[model samples]
Target chain A: MSVFIIRRLLQSVLVLVVMSMLVFAGVYAVGNPIDILISPDATQADRDATIRAMGLDRPMWLQYAYFVKNALAADLGKSFAFNVPAIELILERMPATLELASCAMLMAVVIGLPLGLYAGLKPKSFAGKTIMTLSIFGFSLPTFWIGLMLIMIFAVFLGVLPSNGRGATALLLGIPVSFLTWDGLRHLALPAFTLALLNIALIIRLVRSGTQEALLMDYVKFARAKGLSDARIIGVHVLKNIMIPIVTVIALQFGSVIAFAVVTETIFAWPGMGKLLIDSINVLDRPVIVAYLLIIVTLFIFINLLVDIAYSLLDPRVRLGESDS
Target chain B: MSQQPALSTATPVLQVSGLETHFAARNGIVKPVNGVSFSVSRGKIMGLVGESGSGKSMTGYSIMGLIDAPGKVVGGSILLDGREVRGLDAESLRALRGNRIAMIFQDPMMTLNPVLRIDTQMVEAIQAHEDVGRHAALDRCRAALAQVGIASPDQRLKSYPHQFSGGMRQRVAIAIAILLKPDVIIADEPTTALDVTIQGQILAEMQKLCRESGTALIWITHDLSVIAGLADQVCVMYAGRIVERGSVDDVLDSTAHPYTLGLLNSVPSRNPRGQRLRQIPGMTPSLLNLAPGCPFRERCAHATRECLEDPLLEPVLGHPTDAASAAHQVSCHHPLQTGIST
Candidate 1:
């Protein structure tokens, strides 16, 4: 298992290197950041000095080499927009995004698992069919639109929930977390629900299909014959088998939720990495963009590794080795 | 073993009569187990022999009340130790199952949850019906595993089903079934997927367990040789109906129903070497929209005009009907004469 983890770590490093090169080249292709860095009416000499100072005057390869050299020392250059280390800027926004994504995932599993299991177990019952039909709406509705609807209903009409921003935070282990405060949770509700909509739908479908298939397995019938209560059978036998796929999908979805929650975050004005990424992109903040992309690549690699470990944990047939027994 | 009183004098552990299980398909209501009846006494093993789609497995499932939706036990009287179990409420049925009655399925690989440890599966089976403490349950599970001929029960119990060989997995399943020491166990071809040597060992273990504990076993299989050796009574099923039933020796030696004869003839060892193996002609008739007659008439070589009417189970000529245990019954328009060799 240690060897497997070590190999995965090495692969993650390779991916981050490739991603760094790609991000640098891709940001370079976009209109120059120097124009936005300095005033529009600045003199040519002023422009030249700023460009040289920022190391933008060098050839793209040399610039990438310097970026890589600094990156190896945990130094992602300063964001042009924020005037702070790009990594530091992203890390500052990380907690909000992580909290929101975690809440969304929690909601997805809490709500989707039972509904999906019911739908799969019955499939033809009226309640089961109704749950499935509602899940379709969760999938089809756009996140931004859902975010707006939730805001209008809870904020505008009901006047119960805060529409935008992280309302309040309490220091938990020296990290500001909104969920600890009622006002902060109220602020979190709209954006988190919007972000969770698609994932809930996906989990419902995955678990439903998985449960339906599992119900037909001889083991399930044997369990029934063993006089196990329906709750025990579904909870233990069915849930364990379906968890392999659910864990993989949910982990990957959680990564995407953190990375691509831009629309919902923007709509709700939630200060997260997604908002930082969007703002950085608009200003052509090359360092921030590169840092963000590399972090996301690393997250995906880490999540994939976690999924493999989870797979082995869930399925006894899967062993963490080159050759499976 | 000391001889006990005749099986007929004492109440059988399980008596199933007119058990009909039907499925609602798009086409029609398919009767898989159409009016089957049999009884097994304590410590006796009754073999239910049939080909694929012959409703043998369905009968076992129906007995366990394990039939799923779109299929149900439409009609039946299942008496477990003289208590009617058929049509019992869900809770009551569940209480009886894995407690007073248990089942072992055909494929051991598929019967056990692959993710669960052997101990977890066995412990849960016992705890499901009883309020036993975990330690007591674990002890029972360990003993059950050892009873099924598994070595080092402590180590084996910690492993998952995948860690064991196919034969060993089946033994685990058997161990779970016998954990509660249920009065009756319906083994649905539990040894069918195993090698001959493993099959033989399992059969011996099951027989020994039954003799020692007085558990009535309903061993369902299509292999006549398995029935010939392991079963005291045999019921040959044809197209959802029992075509022949009697003492195993009587049924194998003087097979009455032509379908039973055909099954015996089709055994590769029974046929002459280098000759085309004898096969019963025609396919099994579909249960959906079946004609009102003997289900095996289409395949029976002796099918005649009188066969158009369904045949009722009746005693074979010269068989002693005085003792129900010794009665040799066949459901056929014309049962083959006694002492007729295939």
Candidate 2:
């Protein structure tokens, strides 16, 4: 197990190196951000000084090397827009996105698991069909559109909740959380639920199919033959077996949830990494773009690593066999 | 046959009469187990022999009440200890299962949950039916595993299902079935997947366990040799119905039904070397829309006009049909008087 963890950690480092190269090159491939950063009336001398200061005059390879070395030292350079360290700015905004993403994830799992189980177990039942039908809207409807619809209904028409922003946050573990207060919960509900809708739907579909297949497995039939009650059989026997895939999907989706939060963040004007990303992109901030993407890529890789670890823990065959079964 | 203690005095451990199970398909309802009836006395093994799709496994499922959606026991009575088990509520049925009766599937992997350790699964199997502490249940699990001839049960209990070899996995499954010393055990081709040597060992061990513990067993398999070697009584199924049943010696030496003869002839072991092995002619009739006739009529060599009509399970040989010698009943219009009537 220790060997597996060590091997995965090594793989994650390699993945980050390769990914950093792609992000560095990809960011540079876009037009220079200096055009937007400087005034149109600026003199050539002024532009040259800005270029020299920003190391734009340096060869692309050398600049990339500098970026990698700085990233390795936990210094992602200064953002062209904010004029502050990119890493520091990202760290500042990380908590809000993390809190929101985690909450959305919590909501997805809390609601989706039982719903999926019931639908899968009784796909032909009335409630099962109804849940499945409703879940389609969660999948097909646009997240921003859903966010707008929810705000219009609860915030605009009913006035039951605030229309936008993270409201009334209290510092918990140095992370400002909105869900601590009822008013904050009301404000957090709309966008968080909107972001969660797609995840919940996707998770529901994944779990439903997985559960349906697992329920048909010979082991389940054997469990039934052994006389385990419906509760124990479904809970202990079926649930654990099917959780392996669901956990993998959910973990991988976490990165996407943060990335996809762009539209939701903009629509709700929530102060998060998504909003920060948009602000950086508008001014063509090179350092911020690279750092944001690198962070997301790192997050994605780490999540995948955790999933591999969870896989081995969940199914012994995965740990024992060469192929991940 | 010789070793079985006089078991007739006690009520048979399992009894199924008119067991009919239907599976709903797109085309029509498939009658997999139609009017199937059999009983296994304490300390006896009844071999349910059939080809693929013969409803042998379905019969086992019906007795265990394991039939689920798309398939149901429409009309039947599964009697465990002389109590009608067909209409028992799920809770009561669950109480009877893994306690009064248990099942071993064709795949050991099927019987053992992959995520759970053997000890966890076995202990839970016991605890599911009875209120017992973990250590006490573990002791019973080890005892059961040892009884099934597994070595170092203590260490094996900690291992997961994947840790064990195919044969060893099957032994663990067999151990689970005998965990509670269930009055009856329905093993659906438990040894079908194992090699001959492992199969032989398991068969011998199982026969001995039945003798020692007085557990009635229904061993379902398509292999005739397995039946001949392990079972005291044999029921040969063609298509959702038993065509022949008798004592092991009587049935193997001189079977009454033509399908049974066909089954015996098709075995490669019975054929001479360098010659193509005999196979029964024609396919099994589709149960969904079977013609109004015997299920085996399409494949029977001696099929006559009388065979076009459904043949009641009757005594065609010296053994009276459904009589005390249920061991010798043959549901055939024309029984083999002198030899396999081909």
Candidate 3:
């Protein structure tokens, strides 16, 4: 198992290296931040001085080498716009996105699992059909549109929830998390729900289909024949088998949620890394963009590795280093 | 033939009469187990022999009350030790299953859950019906595994199903079935997927287990050789009904039903060494929209106008009325004469 983890870590390093080069090159291709960083009234002497100070005069490869060197030293360069370390800027907004993403994922699993199981168990029942139909709407509706509708209903008309921004937050483990406070949770509701809507639909479909297939497996029939109670059979036998696929999908989706919540963050004006990313992009903040992409890549690699380990854990047939049969 | 007085006098452990399991389809209701009847005495191994889709497995499922929706035991009286188990509520049926009766399925690979440890699966089977503590249940599971010829039961119990080979997996399933020492066990082709050597070993073990524990066993398979060696009584099923039933010797030696004769003739060992093996003519007829007649009429070489009429299960004529032959019955309008060789 340790060997498997070590191999995965090596692969992850390779992926990180490739991603860093791609991100650095991709951000470099974008128009220079110098245009936006300096004013039109600035003299050429001041501009040259600013460019030299920022090491903008270096060749592209040399700049990338410098970036890699600083990255290895745990310095991802300073944001051209914020003048703070890019990693620090991202980390400052990390808690909000992490909390929101986690809440959305938790909501999706808690709400979707039983409903999907029910739908699979009784595909012909009226309630099952209704839940499945509603899931379709969840999938088809755009995230931004859903966010707007939620705001309009609960915030605009009902006036119960705050329409925008993270409400009062308390420091927990030195990280400001909104969910710990009721007022902050109220502020979190609309955006989180909107974020979870698509994932809930995906989870429901995945679990429902998986459950349906699992119900037909011979082991399930054998379980039934063994005189096991319906609860034990469904809860342990059926649920464990279906969970293999669900775990992989949910983990990948969780990673995507944290990284690509830009639209939802923009709509709700939530102070998150996604929001920071958008603000940085508008000004061609190369350091923040490159850092953000590299971080997201790392997150995906980490999630995929975790998923492989979890997959092996869930299914006994999936050993660590056995060649594929 | 001298009758075994003990077999005739003892009360049967399980009796089913007029069993009918039907499935609803878009075309019409398909009768998979149509009016089947059989009884198994304690310590007896009854072989239910049939080709694929012969409703042999369905009969076993119906007895366990494991029939799913779209197919149900619509009519039947399943007397388990004199109590009618048919039409009982789910909870009541569940209580009897894996406790008083258990089942082993074909494809040992599929019978056990891939994700579960053998110990978890076995212990749960005991705890599901009984209030036994986990330690006691684990002890019982270990004993059961050892009884089924598995070595190092302690190590085998901890391993998951995938870690075991196919034969070993089937042994685990058998161990679980006998864990509760149920009154009856319905094994639906349990050894069908195994190699011949493994199949023979399991068959011998099952027969010995039955003899030792007085557990009535229903061994379902299409292999006549297996039935001849393992089962004391045999029931030949075709298209959802038992076409022939008798003592193993009487059924195999003086086969009455022409269909049974066809099955025996199709065996390569029974046929001439150089010639091509004989196969029963035609596919099994669809249960749906079946005409009111013998289901095998279309395939029987001896079929005539008389076979178009439904035939009742009746004793083969000219056979003595002794207790041994009395138990032998055939459901064919034109049963082949006695003393006919395959």
Count of clashes, each model: 0, 1, 0
Lowest summed lDDT across 10 adjacent residues in model 3 chain A is found at A316-325
What are the per-residue Cα lDDT tens digits for candidate 1 across B1-342? 122345452588799999999999998999999999999999999999999999999999898888887899999799877778999899988987888789998898899999998888989998898788999999988888888889999999899998989999999998888887888899999998999999999999999999889999999999999999999999999888998999987899888899999889888999989999999998899989788889998898889999999999988886545565357899999888865575
Candidate 1 vs 3: which has more TM-score? 3
Off by over 4 Å in 1: B1-9, B318-326
- Per-candidate TM-scores read 0.97, 0.95, 0.98
Interface RMSD of 2: 1.0
Tens digit per residue, CA lDDT, model 3, A25-121:
8888988889999998999999999999899999999999999999999999999997899999998998999899999999999988999999999
Candidate achieving the largest TM-score = 3
Residue-level lDDT of model 2, residues A13-62, one tens digit each, is 89889988998888888888888988989999999999999999998999
Q: What is the DockQ (computed on Cα atoms) for candidate 3?
A: 0.88
| lDDT by residue for model 3 (B123-175), tens | 99999988899999999998999999999999999999988999999999999
- Model 1: DockQ against the native? 0.89
Candidate numbers sorted by TM-score from highest down: 3, 1, 2
Predicted structure with the largest DockQ when compared to the true one: 1
Fnat values, candidates in order: 0.88, 0.78, 0.85
- The list of candidate 3 runs beyond 4 A from truth reads A322-325, B1-9
TM-score of chain A of each: 0.98, 0.95, 0.98
- For residues B1-342, write the lDDT of model 2, one tens digit per residue: 012334562577788889999999999889999899888889999999999999999898888888887889999788777778898888888988888888998987566889999888898898888888999999999899989889999999999998998899999988989998888998999998899999999999999999999989899999998998899889888789988887787687778888888888898978888999899988887889667678887777788999888888875556445554545778888888654443
Better of 2 and 3 by lDDT: 3
TM-score head-to-head 1 vs 2, winner: 1
The candidate that achieves the highest lDDT relative to the unseen native structure: 3
